[model samples]
Target: MHVTWGRNIGTTVQSEEDLYFSANSENWFDMSSLGAFDTYTSDNDWVSVEKMVPPVETDDMITTRDVSKLCEDISSLYLNEKFSDVILVLDGEKLHAHKAILARCEYLEALINDGSQHLQQSEIAITDVSPEAFKKLLKFIYTVSTITITSNVGLIVEVLELARQYCFKDLENATIQTLKSALNLKNICSTLNIANLYDLSDLKQACHTFVDQNALEIVTGDGFTDLSQKSVIQLLERDTLLVPEIEIFKSVSKCKLNDDDDNLVIGSVRLSWLTVEDIVSTVWPSKLVEDEKLLGAIVEIVEVKAKTSVCRAKKCMKNNHNWRKIDL
Candidate 1:
């Protein structure tokens, strides 16, 4: 998810996967992220949860500016002691809040209505979510605006997890965009894996492209050498790898030599492209036995392959042979 917002106007995005949006004139953005406001109608009235955000479009779509002024007005009342209806004890610090806004958090709303004596007291305490994280959440809830992400790059993943956990779809997308922007050489591999896990398709492709472009570096990088089996398997399956297959073979060999578990991932590699010696040394050493017979057949095919004086050792001049002659 990538969000590019213009000043009080449009938002451009280059999404990698699914973005579910409800279509209607009244509903334009999901308010659940910010106290579950439902939709932003011209009257600022509430609607059913079903009437949520429509697809992110630049033309005729509303920006956060719609209710942004309203949020600022509401925020003014947040810190006023006389106007505050609820108190939040977060990580030992007390903060003023409101029932209407807090109700957006379905879990908190349920707890408040569960007849707990504490709810009757208009006070709630939380120890799990950090104050810093909660503060950012509250800021977004009250501002209906972007939470500064550049300075908080290190915490992007954490914020994303928090948003997803709390069903804050818009916030989750914002955090993902931050994560994508913060991707770097050191974290690219793990980021790629995480993106794949969370289906952040745009970030995943960016990571994949990084791997392809920096194949040699990544293959030799500390964390990448220990890359997970799934990532390794996926990398081996690509035809656009920047390095030669031989180099990949060496890299994978080094990886398996370090951990036998990597041997399983190596099974998926197309061994037919490897040289006869590589098949014997690397593929044969591993327990990918299924390739043995095929390798033997390939060897036989290469051996019986007609090679004249001019074409003997020069691979550039090698001609195709009827591979069907090789026994399975």
Candidate 2:
């Protein structure tokens, strides 16, 4: 019997004559026919397919295992996980604390040398700083270990705090040296105040000694006005040698003879032996020969009275003819 086949179907024989073509062959023929239908239709189908299908993205999975591996790699340098733990602990502390430990480490390294060769040769004793301290120091070096001076006075003082807490002698010495360089009368006052508060006997003594030695500069200038009365008194008391020049005399008579005013005069009768030459040189150039002769006579008479009375025997000085002065 004759049977109708779908359009574009390929010829295929079946067991029965009812249908000789297969639907698969007809479907393949239909798909090939669709390609020639229209470019727009093919484009539309592709566009719809693309919109229906979600975009694929590359996955960058950063898991805890990866982080742990990274940390393990870093910890390999020290060959210990405990060091990594210490680093994590250091990260949790204050940023300054971390920096201080680092600075201390650098200072220790410079002081001791690589592999502690210098430490061994010099035989210097190590204090509270141990292997753990070095680990903390490294954590600081890798993290933050810089101390910034925001205020003028707090810089060295804060360093001292760190040094004291960590028992770092080098750091303490560095702080003291910096303090010495920065010290002025005003700042020294603050340093002294801190020393008192902290009960730093050595620092207090150093400040006191510095102030005492530089008293002239610190106590007499415009800067001195800023100092308290107590500070001034303390400086003055300690620096007794800074007292104003004193006019010494064997007796009151010697002190009074050197009259403050003098245009020109031959040897004055009251001039002491110690100042006799000075009086002669100053007066000799201006005096007449007769006046010089008169001055010499007056000097002799005063000397005679001075020797007999010791400037206290009234009768001895009264009997001397030189005691009765003439206008000449």
Candidate 3:
């Protein structure tokens, strides 16, 4: 006799069999993965266990097979041009698609319905995006419910740009999330650049946080020299930047920017935070700053340090005054 249980729970073939107490009873085990039932052993009582059975389907439920078949049917129509009404000319290749499916994209809908040149022409030449990225866009249009995004960084970035250009909000969001998860020391700079270019505020903020947290490593890395002057300024101005002021100064000096931007980028560094010796030894020798500006910054650091020392001395004197001769 077969006894039914909840989905992913083991089934029973006999009545009143000793139920083994597996601490992992809630987890489903694939019996097929093991050669036989004798392969599984529990120190506790052995139950008449069988492999977990597929859940019984109800009218309200949708099965995985049904969803798979639906996606497959929809995907089969992708690039099938037999009844296609529009041809998207991307780069040097032509992609055939139906207007109804293309209409799902807000940008394409506006172009197809409103653009004078696009309204009647069956072929539209797209120059801004490559065919590979656009193919992902079409796949999403066809099977959004089941489409898998590529993990390749370059392709994902292309999709991000295409998604934003086409106003594919879901695809854009998914791409941003993927980028966030994919962030690392090597790609953080380029990823930040992409975020800034696309005005992806969420991803931009994540990159900023990552940069600030890994400031020393990021500033010392090779990518530091590739940052734009404006990006470097923005990074240096951040209050949470965890790198030493000397490193910030050194990295900003290495950025490939014009002389005019050098003044701006250098201004973002807290010159007063650098020690007098550091200014004379490192900053002064580097010649990143003019003699006049270097002198002023050095003087300012000296004054601040002197004042700090005075305050500490006074505090120490006051504490000494509070200590009275005590007799044991």
Candidate 4:
């Protein structure tokens, strides 16, 4: 005979002949007369135990795979998505993988945030600059994105730093172009400071050239007094590449003289070698015309004054006396 139990729960038992029979109504079990059937220790218990082991182990393995896969997919997505957005046109193209790009962005952001924190902690409001402009900074970092400077002076400076950080050749060249174009007498001092800080030799040369070209104008302007002592000395020490034209010297002479009062004395004027001819022509135009002895004395005095750096020329000496005889 066969004995069945818990048909609704899919548990059953079979026996050819039962010496004794006992089974749970809710669960089924087969037993010999020698031992009692225990419903709690049957196939259902084994099934539950087996189920628990696999899920725990399976979950762990799945978690490991998902983490690794996530990392790879995210990296690939960034490379594929962000690379196409680089718009700067240059001779060489820079391509970056997603992982590296993200890392660079994070680093730059940290730098900016750290700088901001320093400014805030120091209570230096004026030094508080926005990192907003650095949005494109990261693209230049990992991918060495091509940079085109149309007009923004500040952006040019920023890009130069970015190039230096990433060792981007083409981006650095673009920055140099912008620096060259933006230089002028008014800003040359600031440009020089920036170049020195960043160790930009080419930028330093460009600034020097600008200052040299506009030496006279810069020295005479109100802005000259505002320059730092170091900047003034640097300007003075730079080699004069070319002399100023006669017309420029004439202008300088007119600037030194008092328009309303011819008798007024002007003090020492320092002129560069480039502008010496212009100065001589303006002060002694008559010397070029007359080889006469009287005119020679006046020319000699002018030459002496120019040489001594005591550029004051007297309109009229005591009793209308020509001091030319004094060997001045």
Candidate lDDT scores, in order, read 0.60, 0.41, 0.72, 0.44
Worst 10 residues of 3 by lDDT: 307-316
- Cα error of candidate 3 at position 100, Å: 2.0
lDDT of 4 by residue, 194-255 (tens): 77677678887887767665656765654555444344445544345222333323333444
Across 1-328, the per-residue lDDT of candidate 1 in tens digits comes to 2222212223322221122344343444432344432233344342222322345566766668966876678767654565678888887788887777766666557756767466577778866775777777766665545656464454666666677777887777777766667766787777777777777787778788777656667866776666666678777776555454545656676663334565565665445555566556665675544655656646764775523111001112235631111111
| Candidate 3 per-residue C-alpha lDDT over 36-97 given as tens digits, one digit per residue, 9 for 90 to 100 | 34534544433445545334437987778989998788678788877899888888788888
lDDT-wise, the better of 3 and 4 is: 3
Error of 1 at 112 (Å): 3.8
For model 2, residues 62-93, the per-residue Cα lDDT tens digits are 66898888755543443233332122233233
- Per-model TM-score on C-alpha atoms: 0.59, 0.29, 0.65, 0.36
Clashing pairs in 4: 243-274, 244-274
State, as a TM-score between 0 and 1, how close model 3 is to the true structure: 0.65
Ordered by TM-score, highest first, the candidates read 3, 1, 4, 2
Let me know the TM-score candidate 1 reaches against the reference structure.
0.59
- Model 3: pairs clashing at backbone N, Cα or C within 3 Å: none
Best by lDDT: 3
